[model samples]
Target: TEMFESDNVDLKKQMQTYNGLDHPFSIGDELLVENSQFLLKMKTDMPNVVVFTFNDTSSWKSDMNIYKAHSGFTLEAQNLPNDINLLGKDAPSILQKDQAFYSRTTYQIIEKLL
Candidate 1:
């Protein structure tokens, strides 16, 4: 199980807040903030893994509270697309790969003034 990792500097120590219904934001919400860092990881299945940190992105325009917005991150596992051929065809099933073998990537989220 190959592994990959990345980090954001300015976002190391910050806070984030989100609001909405029980479901909140969807998979691709395009989060925004002043200066924040995110850490994304790609496990056995590249598409199935997502890791990110949100800092200082909440507002009173909606519901929720400070506790919910104060420092939050997520490590989500999803399903990879069927068309993606990561292993050159000869590779074994994703389940067969060792748990330690994983890949990751990191990025940052910035608020764009529209």
Candidate 2:
């Protein structure tokens, strides 16, 4: 049971009685616990709530962190290898950018987990 303060808003205030966090939760809707780090995995259940699984890289405990319902950030789903290529020459650069974004975000997750 942890609560974090962000933008003067109390994240997890609604989480006190909900025990749904144990299993996979929603994506994009979760607050990043003020100062925590989480490695993004993939998306599940589009539109309603694009949930993404995350790895708690900073933790020695080897636990998975699922960030559900994150609506504020401009997080685009990573294009799968099998997906159609729409970017033409920009594909390589876009993938590289995504990699960098995930890497940096994972680092931030590590800081929060510690």
The local lDDT score (0 to 100) that residue 41 gets in candidate 1 is 29
Query: Can you give the TM-score per candidate against the true fold?
Result: 0.24, 0.20
Model 2: per-residue lDDT, tens digit, 1-114? 132223323234323323112122234423233323555343332222222222132343444643433212333323332223655666432445446533222212333356
Number of the predicted model whose TM-score against the real structure is largest: 1
Off by over 4 Å in 2: 1-10, 19-38, 50-114
lDDT of 2 at 103: 25
TM-score of 1: 0.24
Give each prediction's root-mean-square deviation over alpha carbons: 14.6, 13.1
